[model samples]
Target: MTEPRICSDDYGILTSARDWLAAGREPALVTVLKTWGSSPRPPGSLLVMCRDAGHAGSVSGGCVEADLLERYRSGELGELPTRVDYGVNREEATRFGLPCGGRLELLVEALTDAAQLDELLAAMDAHRLLAREVDPASGRVRLRPAGPEPTFACGESGVTRVFGPAWRMLLIGAGHLSQYVSRLALMLDFDVIVCDPREEYARDWQVPGTRLVTLMPDDAVAAYTGHPRSIVLALTHDPKLDDLALLDALVSDAFYVGAIGSRRNCELRRRRLRDMGLPESQLQRLYAPVGLPIGSHTPPEIAVSILAEITALRNAAAPSAGARSITAA
Candidate 1:
């Protein structure tokens, strides 16, 4: 899988892009178009350092900043856009101290057209993935659909794809545990939705910014059409509700589908799902014993474990990927 792209706007790159766009002068956008060997960030990592606005995005692990800063100070990048390669050999790697001999290729594009920059920003704000191509020799910019094309922009500079939006979470229960989970989800920038059909539960739900709904759990999951970016957790522990919701969630695109239950109950639930025509692979996606094995015995403690696991999944830094890969029950 391709490493996800970072938004120029998200990492405070908007300020630099805006300043250059406002000045009616082209500014250099230095992006770590590709990387090999040990690197802090993946491909598409960016540094939109402009002539006037300074720097955005980290290309190297603080090793290249001094040189980049010097280049910025000397106006070496102002002439036009350029492609620069760093860490060619052992000596160069030692000079830069790239930590594990990492080599990075940077594509610098002179963004002269404010309209194009504005369009890129708007597309990102709207949660669209964009592939930006620049001419290595001429520094011309072109926006194309994000995918594998031998070459885009008609043999221009290499392509850098920018991915937008954080992941989303939907909680099927708005109970005590849901409160803590929702709070942490917001802090993690996940768009959260809480669903509960019980009037009392929905009425008593008081967490701010969480989308509260009284829809049936199964219908709510169906309506959501959970995607790879979505996570659904059935914390109600009520089979009548959670079972159906879990059934819907397992068949959807949700990357994580979990429920709060004991080992025995989880086994029963799995058997029922398997009997309902769910494939063994699909059934395996159910994280019945949700969260990590932190021996969490309380609602708030369980919430912390759940949030930690979710964060690991989101960052792709988890020791193991997949729903049942980590179980605390």
Candidate 2:
């Protein structure tokens, strides 16, 4: 007997939808199109619901899925791609359990073939960023290569949603602090890679969902497929190791390059790198003190600060006052 399949995350949703289609079930793929005011899910959130009421992913927290399923079951929803609105007013918001002032539009399209799903899933499996362009009026869709990030846009031309591999984090150490950072980065959907040549430190490193590299730190950076979606962190606190990684990372396209150290040590390291002939422009890219100025001490707290700063920069948001605060002694 064939075992049942398992699915998780956004990619898994499409995988499950493809499976349902293969089993002769017409599954409707729902995408949150536009949201006004407050919303349970963002504009790009996806949900795939089978004719049997089985569903994967979520457009709303849980408020509207049932009603959506009922509409499809009762034939209120059509085969052609169409748009539906929910919570247009206060009464409707209350009925759908949506927050006050919450309103959203959804585009639902029924899948009759697994061809497109197969193609998109293949691209994702190959770690290639891909975007799906959907024409709601014509029930047509096409795929194209996308940038390093996922983005959703809708306009007079229809809808475009980008999906692909997760961002990556390369930690140039397998020490205690690196352990905490790796775990947190994994939780945040980063493909974490920890590199350490020292068996003494690497032997005890066993963080699940993270790749361990025994290559020299500099060599690891070179082999990591440096790209705009990658980040490199030096947490060994050893100039010999961290400096080598930083030297290569700062010159690469990694979105963030950071080294964990005190102010004095950071300045000294910067001076050393500058003296080694690293251009002033490249030298400025180093996040020497690493993380935010949150004044974190312990390994876990320090991990939080590091990830928080990365998250802020990744989202292109300004650091909040609290995040920029130096904890009082």
Candidate 3:
């Protein structure tokens, strides 16, 4: 098994906030409520700062965090939740390390309820999706089941940000391509699990920060919980292993299912799976000959193309702005 991964999610920050509050220390929780133009971090990014000068997570590269820390320490940010904006103009954007023309609006709240933080963390631990809503005027926080997708919204009424597990990627093979794919996925904040049952392949699979499962591909898929936030990539290029995983992933709710192969091989694999009883609708969900048409041939280039396509599809599927419904209270 590979070494444990550094969790690439906000849960670590939330956990730290809970611990600090439980120790009778008041900390400030800053959330990026909105962004315009070329912001460094997206809306829903988190930053938690303790009065003792410790901090976790980030809303910007570094400058914004420095300013936020100063304000937090100087008591400018009080117990009540308030909105703070940075990089409203080009000069400010440069000063704050945001891209030119970038703008960020933040919600800063003093955390006093360890119970609430614990409850939110509990939901996440149980694999339950949740949305946290904060009222600026009254400093009230509410938690409820989140929608099928993650989202963030803010207006005069308050701020609502969905919190859920980190996205996951399950690779069906531990080949050379799998190594590159796994490394790239980790950098993108995905929990990567690789399944390769062959003793020869599994023995030398030494990618830190990834989990290696020896179970058969189909059983690995079954145990992985193909939730909507999951990605399944069959990189084995072997019909015996890759096909077994595809049969399971195609029928599941995993947001992205892909297989790396030549166009001809992909079509052949498609027919093979279809003949094995996978419906046309589910088969249509498969991204065969996976990756964008970037003409990639090398392992590293192919890995980049694969992740690029996944990123494009994921963003394309995000809820429309109208669904989040920004409004002033």
Point out the higher-scoring one by lDDT: 1 or 3: 3
Clashes of each: 1, 0, 0
lDDT of 3 by residue, 235-283 (tens): 9889999999999988887878888888788888988998999987777
Alpha-carbon lDDT, every model: 0.70, 0.82, 0.82
Ranking by TM-score: 3, 2, 1
lDDT comparing candidate 1 with the true structure: 0.70
For model 3, give the 10-residue run with minimal summed lDDT.
320-329
Per-candidate TM equals 0.71, 0.88, 0.88
Selected candidate, larger TM-score, 1 vs 3: 3
Q: For model 1, how does the per-residue alpha-carbon lDDT over 1-329 read when each residue is reduced to its tens digit?
A: 12223323343565566775686544556667667787666655667665544676677877776677677668775566666767878677778867577887777666667777666666555544466666567656677655322211323434645444345677988899999999988887676889999998899999886778788998888765365556899999888888889888988877788888888888888888878888877777777678877899998899998988877766567754443433432
- Give me candidate 1's TM-score against the actual structure: 0.71
- Collision count of model 3: 0
List candidate 2 segments past 4 Å from native. 1-8, 319-329
* Native-structure RMSD, model 3: 6.0
- Candidate 3 TM-score versus the reference: 0.88
What is candidate 2's lDDT per residue for 1-329, written digit by digit as tens?
A: 12112122667888999999999878999999999878988888999998799999899878799999999988898665889999999999888878867998999998876888898787666656788999999988888888755478888998999876557789988989988998898788788888999999888888877888899989988877466677999998899999999899888977788888888888888888988789877877788688876768999999999998889887668453223322210
